[model samples]
Target: MSDTTATPTRPVNWTAISITAAVVMGGILAALLAVAPRDDGGIAWFDPMIPGGWMAWTLPVAIFFWCIASLLVTFTILAIRFPETPRVGVLRIETTRGDRLFISLLGSAFICLVWLFFAGLPVWGALALCLVYAAAVFRWV
Candidate 1:
């Protein structure tokens, strides 16, 4: 008699997954930019709402690109160097990669909103806060 229990298997190659995710994110960004509406001045339609500064000229796109790039780099690094790092969950519950990503994105949005509501200009401050939030989420949720 043969016992039939399924055993879990690790992915054969995390590097490929990381590279694929980066390429897919880049493609999505490119597609969005390609179809996004522009104003007469060649700026994005939402440029007026974005804060102005040396690096804020292309605010939304810059932030979006930065976030994606950060995620890609982080995933690559984690996959290559810290594949065994344990992921913490919300309320001490077990969490997966998707959960952590969701928490990070949500935290970032909250940070941006709080910054917009209470503070103005120099979004770097908010970015710093968001980075801390992301770190906390990854570490403890």
Candidate 2:
């Protein structure tokens, strides 16, 4: 047979890709929620080496910004590589991945805000809630 290795394969399964995108975004959201500090008037910092003894509010915020930057990179990649079939589906929107990421981000932000308000949990306690939130979102959603 003639060599045709240079020929490109069929298009990727955007549906599956979108799902993964959703999951990843969700995970990032969970991480942000978990790391964010609670509103309680207690100092939550401790030995950095210890497992859960110490954590600062800025850590999660920094992580959140990083994840957002990564998502931006992913968007750029998809836009450049798949310029033709960019949209996932009409039902989802022009870009389903973007939509999902937006929703996940918003939801996580909302959760964080709520925790910041009502729970009044200390930094350590918020960390526990964040872990549970991440688990539930990943497993259920």
Candidate 3:
């Protein structure tokens, strides 16, 4: 009988991963608070978070970057823990988890652009469609 399990090149340093996750989460929380509008006008430390109208940094843009960072971190952890081998999917080409992630992200971007052209802003509906599209890509593509 032949063994199938692939051995990891190096042991995963769980402490480092945990610390990284904590830092990522902390940054996200800090960003959220920074963009939050307060009735006190953000004067004192206890007043509230930072001013939202600081340069080009908007709440939505911050959240988007945070989400992207979180996804990358999650995928990195999964790769370290599971170590996937590229497999052929519906596309009849070998693809790893990272490849699927890339495809989904690219497709989602296109879907948003097309949806914007036809449906206009408040992209909640487009977001739902993108979620479905991403699920489909991860499942079969």
The numbered model that scores best in TM-score is: 3
Can you list the residue pairs that collide in candidate 3? Answer: none
Cand. 2 Cα-lDDT: 0.59
Which portions of model 3 show Cα errors greater than 4 Å?
Answer: 1-23, 39-55
RMSD of 2: 11.0
How well is each residue in 14-75 modelled by candidate 2, as lDDT tens digits? Answer: 77877777778778667655655545754243313234555543554456576677778677
User: Model 1: per-residue lDDT, tens digit, 1-141?
Assistant: 897998988866867866877787778666656655577857475663335545533547655766667676676667566655455565676676556867798879889998988988868999999889888887776
Model number with the top lDDT: 3
Tens-digit per-residue lDDT, 5-88, candidate 3: 998798669889878897978887686866565555752333323455455555566667778888888889889878999999
Point out the worst 10-residue segment of candidate 1 by lDDT: 48-57
Candidates' lDDT values, in order? 0.70, 0.59, 0.80
How do the predictions measure up, each by TM-score?
A: 0.50, 0.37, 0.72
State how far residue 137 of model 2 sits from its true place (Å).
9.6
Q: Rank the candidates by TM-score, best first.
A: 3, 1, 2
Choose 2 or 3, whichever is better by TM-score. Answer: 3
